[model samples]
Target chain A: MTASIRQMGVITAHLIRKVAFNPAVVWLIAMPLVIIYILGITMHGLFSAEFTPVKPYRIVVALPEEAGFLVERISRAPKHFAVEEARDAQEARQAVFQRQADAAIVAADGDEPLTVIAPPGSIVLEMLAGVVQASLEQEAQQVAAAQPPVENGSREESDTGARSAGAADGALSAMPWEGVGSFEYFSIGLIVMFMAFASHSAMVHCVQDRSTGAYLRIRALGVTRAVYLGAGITSGMLLGAGFSLVMAVITWTLFRVVWGNAAAWALMTIAGAASVASLSFLLTALLPSDPKGVENAGGTVYSLLAFFGGSTVPLTIMPRWFSEIFSWLPNRKMLDGYLKIVKGAGVKEIEQELFGLAAAALIMLGLAWLVVMLLKREEV
Target chain B: MATHAAVQEARGQAAGDPSIVVEGLRKSFGKNVAVDGLSFTVHPGEIFGLLGPNGAGKSTTLSIMAGLIRPDSGDVKIGGHSVIRETQRAQRLMGVVPQGLAVYEELTAAQNLDYFAKLRGIEKKRRRQEIEEILELVGLSGVAHRKVAQYSGGMKRRLNVGIGLLGRPRVLLLDEPTVGIDPQSRRHILDSVRRLAESGMAVVYTTHYMEEVEYLCSRLAIIDRGRVIAHGPIDEVRALAGDAVVLRLPFPRGVLDEAAKVESLQNTLPMPVEVTSGELRIVLPQGSRQAPAVIEELQRHGVPLDGMRLESPNLETVFLSLTGKALRDGKAAEEGAMA
Candidate 1:
């Protein structure tokens, strides 16, 4: 294991020197910053003008200890919903009753159903109730499947084992935040997009190695194929993730864009790096060891992922089917998570996006391994 | 006192002990049969050469020994470690200098050596010293800090050889390491390989140039169409080549119609005669004894013959006489190279 790690370290250094020393790397990093600035300034007005062209529905929420996860699930994810924390259930209900807030949700703490407060015939009333009922119904079914038929267990709809795990970390503080500015949104989107491109560009080393027979040389020098490939992927991931973080810092310092909590942004950047690196590895391994083939395939995949995933073209301008179908792309997931962070969401709120990115990395890595094994078998 | 000299001595095994054992190797690339039941062994402190025309499976055989390709039926053992079953350990005992330049162009020569040394599991502290010594050995110490992209072809080839010298393995496999280079650089590489063998490292040298094999290797195998046509010490292989002498008779380009003259010679002369690019060669069945009869016959055919020379049995002669094809068959070699 020590020898493997040492080999990985050496291969990483080789890759870094090979990739970072090239003059084109300067353009690869600098171009994105320029594009983000220009596009942000150009598209400022479009983002400012929402479809409704009215104030967002102000939903005053009261989390009774255990229901923070459900309220965050329901209140978050939609940029159009603005949230405010009510001090207590009475205050939440009174504020809506007195016409100060559009709606209020008093979540169930333990053994008690949630309460909803809204004016009659108000759109917020029906929307909030319907979302909360759907969540409660899902929770009810989970409770039913987890336990035997106990009449008293029905009231156990409080924060369960899974939801309470986040409590120790602290409450899910969905701070009062406004929507992202055009510059901030574009900066995050382009950073994610360029990071993927950067990973693909980093793979030029592997292509050159293969053509020059350096890969076979390295393997003959006692390094396994897996170790050589892993070193490349890990090194590219670090370089790409570091580059994205630097971009975030630059935007935050220069354009005054808030990328949410630092820890969350860093995690999201690492996750994005893993996904892009694995995608590059799989593409290289699956192709016919030709640089042009890898390049063309990567270019097509990157372009499509960005086009439909809100990086190249905004989801607002995309067709509904595109929005529905391609929204699950890794790039799309990254952009969505980054936009939320820009909107002041933290690690807890973007947990699913983080999980999705991690899962994508694992799946790509697994597929790359499978392809390499098949090729080796055929060679044998 | 330097790390390279010390490492060389410390890692050096006893000379004349077999370090490579290739047994019944068979590999077929979709029916091409790259290496068919080939076998050989090389001992420490000896240079074993494999000579064959293009596509004679020289590179493929070296690749199998380097653990890059898996043979269909047999195995290569590096100092008792199986290249197939214990590939990593076997690889650690051997190094491969590939036909192409494997050094990274973006990195300095020293940097390339240092990175490969590290990947070879040399500790960080010893890596700098080892890399410096390697640069000195490859005659690149003066320009070690320059990127390989800026180096001349000979310098790049030298660095390619230097990378294979990283771990001081028991065996080294060099597949035409000096294909196209300045004569001085080629000389330096040959001297370095000699020094390596002196330090008790077994070297497997493959080349198209027969003189290189005669100058460096004590034993060699002549492979033809994925099979060993001749194998043994230099004298033994030459003995197998027989006492048949090659007679080179030159003629002005336009003076001889190659096709008509070749037909005329084949029909009239009672010897194996072939027309090459610039000359006609007739192999004397019996040494210089048959030379006069061949000359008289050529003269009787109204063939204008320049001063002819009788070339005795050598590696090239052995290769041609055994394989029935010139060692450097120009057209076939070009096509093989392109492939």
Candidate 2:
């Protein structure tokens, strides 16, 4: 018993000396900080009006005096698009098809109204078609009612419809995070990546202990396997968890990202930190003798998770099949959980994600334990 | 005279039981047998050399005895505790310096000792003192705080020996401790082993170097092919080969063949005449009485001989006489197989 305690003490001290004092820690923290700052500057520039060009796109108008009401309404679009008159429907269609104009509006009176066309799905054509259709509808309604008496009565309903439509459009266009910046989401994931790398790199020494015969020498001292592995995982979790917390602080200060409720986010970070550490340990255990195998496997897994799990794109915009597949990955669950809390989602919203992260943590830890046992059994 | 007697009494009181005992201990890795029915006892206050060339099961035997790996069958008792039934007890009683230098090179000598000392269950108060004493014992006191990676090969070997002593174990097992070491470091390690034995610790030392065994071991075993071929006191084993007349002579090549052609000299010489590297070796079951006849025959053959001398057999001769091969040759072959 005394010998086992001594063995654990020695191993723990060795782990701390090597990992906590290693020069790589400096770069692990520094690289992420540099990336976060650069991304923050870049994102800010993209959103700033000084750097972005904003102007009403020009559209071609084609109509005769017989359709004066339609022409007038189309001309009245406020700052959304400017109207340019074409010689006829033929000229307007040519302009629209040739990409010389955003869209062409062709109006016909006393016949089926003609609208010059192009395929949908083009952002420019979609916006042009919306403007033209809205103008035509307003003109037709006004002519039929011959009145502006009900503006107050229907104003609230129209406003609500416009807001809902705007939200749906934003969800389709942006990466996840409820129309907030991608930097906020990417910064969090990058920070988590740093923690994972740092922890895995540090814990690789445990594998070295085996290859170098330090582990065998210590085992002869009668140390229990638990204390030895416990010290290792403990060291990894502390380093990974502490690094992630620092990243959260940096994210909040530099990017103005809302990390949601402080208490809830802290809880999620703790769970995520444990899961990342266990994953690293499990990966190190499963890999062959080479240390690079661990690095390759861990890197490949992290990259795949980040790319597919709505961390790179909004989940709602993903194809239906991909949503089903990526939803099973831990990264998606973790990001969703983090996003929910950051977006002020309540406990009810994040419970499933929290459980999923926990389950992942359990599976990884269980596999790590199994590997340690197999190694110990081989010693005997 | 009375004071000398009192010192002797005090020394005997400090001495412990035999540090190691093995009975019918056997082990194998898959189909290849490593240690086959090996049995030996190492008494306290002696450097017991388990000598072999290579693949002679020296390392496998040591591993089983040291509690690092379990024997496939049989019993290993360390300081009166059964290794299999009471592993912790066995471990606490013995410290093993493995075939490789297993200390973490990144850690300082003091830190390494303190770390292992804690694992050996030394109290915190005594741990620092033990580290200091061990460092001094190994002559590493001046550089205890320096990183081990920066240390010389000799310094690292000394620290490795020091690590094995941290527990103050009743028994110490050193597996090829001086392999690849400089002469100065090897001598220092031999001196340390002598000192440890003088202080009443039973040590099981394994090495392929025949001279190391001759210098330090009080009792020894010469193993071959996973079995002990010859084992006893150094002098007794040497005597087993009887008297060998070794003649260092600047003699012509093929002198032995030429000498053997003489009809009058053939029956009168020693058991056999062998030539190696310009030297003639004649092993006589009796003594060197046939030297004159051998000299005359060499002269008759027109073989110019210089620096003629005769000496009795040593361990090399004993090993050769018993196994019909040199100890070192066997070790070389084994190492080749391992490589």
Candidate 3:
């Protein structure tokens, strides 16, 4: 017992020296930091843009009767526009085409038929067009009422309001990126990418040690299997946490993005790393003794998992069945949980996801332990 | 002079207990039996050599003693502690130098020693001193700060020896200690072992190198097929092949006519002379006076001797007599299988 404990201390010291001083060890640690730095820089702009206070859209109205209400709604609405009125439809079109106004509303026939126009693919224009069209349609229906105008009681106004509300909901739902910027989406994807690289590299080290007779040497020193594996997971955790933090800082400095609570984020970093370490150990153990076997099997497993886990595609956009399948992949659970934490989710909000990640980590670590125990029993 | 002084000190302290004893050890790996019903005892202050071919169970026996591998059936006692029952206690009394260079390549030699010394629970104050002493003892002081990866094979082997000596166990088990070392490093290692023995460390050295056994071991066991074929003093072991004087003489012309003269010469000389092929090999009853008379008889017959080799038996003949084949042939066969 004393021998084992003393050996553990020795092994720990070596681990520190390897991670702290050796170039290979430094590179193992530094590679993740570099990725984090790159991702933080790359994704910072997107997060800031997603959450930034949106500016009002400039508009021009070319309608005579219905245009009055359109201009009022454009000017007075909570998040609609900066209002302007063009003399005619031609002038309004010119305003939009010349980039002077983001959108224009023209009243065309009796009861004032409305034609809403904006620059193609312009987010501000798209929102403004929907807003102006709703106001104009309301005014047109108000004039069509046959009964006395009762205060807040016209059936046509209520009907148009309901339709407008439904249309507004549809428009918002159509563009997912409108609410979540491209940077946030990219940041989430980079987290998974970093994990993949870290896990793969960790497995490579395991294979090297096994084949090179180093494992046998260490075993002969009375270093138990548990100590050996615990050190491995510890190394992986250090790598993952160091990587995630660098990436987070870089993300903040470059994008001016704000992340969640520091404590929550710290737990996320540790959990994420533990999950990756488990995965790396599982994959390394699954690989046959042949060097080429790892390449072949690892390629298939990585590709399939990355595809399903939203590393390459957003899980939200994937088919319902595909998403359901992804729930089974530990990578998906971790990435989902990590993204939620990074996206400013509170502990209560991400509790279920965190539990799921923890469960997967434990299962994977348990499996790795079993496999390693079996392997140890075989030869050395 | 130092060796004499150390040996004198050892004699004063040498106690009644045997250092290591193995009885009826049996171990099998899958279908192959590694050590089968093997047994031996190593007394204090003796260099006991385990000599055999590659698969002759030498390594298995050493590993069992070192507590690295569990024996299927056996009783191994180190300083009166059962290896299986009191492994840590038994291991505390022993140090093992494995066949492979087990030193960490990423660490400096001193760092490697320091790490292992700490594992062995050497006092913090004494650890550095002991590491430096072992480094100097192994003649690796100048290069102690260099990472083991930069070391030549011989340097690594020497460091392997140094680590085994760090805890200063009562018994040191070295598996091919001089293997892969340069001639200088090899000599340095052998001398270190000699020093340890003189200082009263019972050493169990396993190797296929007979010259090493002859040079370093006072007693040896010739093992084959996982069994000890012979074990005793080196001279006693070699005596299994009777006393024979080997003469490297010129090929005699009249082989059949010389046979009659050699027989007549045998009656007059103190030893019996037999001519096989070209050389006259004489088996003495046990006297040195026969050589002069044999030389005179060969001269009388005009045997025209070009050269002569006269010596008592050695391990080579002993090994051949026991195995019915040379040790080298058996080692070649084992290497072939491994390759």
| Whole-model lDDT values for every prediction | 0.76, 0.68, 0.66
Error of 3 at B83 (Å): 2.2
Instruction: Label model 2 with its docking quality class.
Output: acceptable
- Cα RMSDs of all predictions? 12.9, 10.1, 13.3
lDDT order, best first, reads 1, 2, 3
Candidate 3 lDDT by residue in tens digits, B1-339: 455445545656445556889889988878888888888888767789999877799877877777666788888998889877886688777877877676778889998898777767788989888898999999999999998999987789899888888777888888887765567778889999988887878899998877789999988989987988988999898888775434336446465476577667667655445444455555533434556766777787666667776666677556655664445443443432332
Worst 10 residues of 1 chain A by lDDT: A160-169
Can you tell me which runs of candidate 2 are displaced by over 4 Å? A1-10, A39-176, A250-262, A287-324, A345-349, A372-376, B1-17, B53-57, B224-226, B236-339
What is the interface RMSD, in angstroms, for predicted model 1?
Answer: 1.6
Kindly report which residue pairs in candidate 1 clash with one another.
Answer: none
TM-score: the better of candidates 1 and 2: 1
lDDT of 2 by residue, B144-173 (tens): 999999998888888888898987877888
DockQ agreement of candidate 2 with the native complex: 0.35
| DockQ (0 to 1) for model 1 | 0.44
Candidate 1 lDDT by residue in tens digits, A1-380: 88888888888877876667778778877887888888888766546633331466777887664566566666663654577888987787677767777777665455444555655323354345445655665566776665312112121112110111111112112211125677887787788888887787667577768778798798888777767888889877987887787788888887898777888888888898999999998888887378788888888988877777777665533323455576668887788788888787799988988999999999999998898888755332
Q: Which digits, one per residue and each the tens of the lDDT, describe model 2 over residues A100-121? A: 8766656533443545344332
lDDT of 1 by residue, B34-93 (tens): 998888998777789998877889988988888877888898989989999998888988
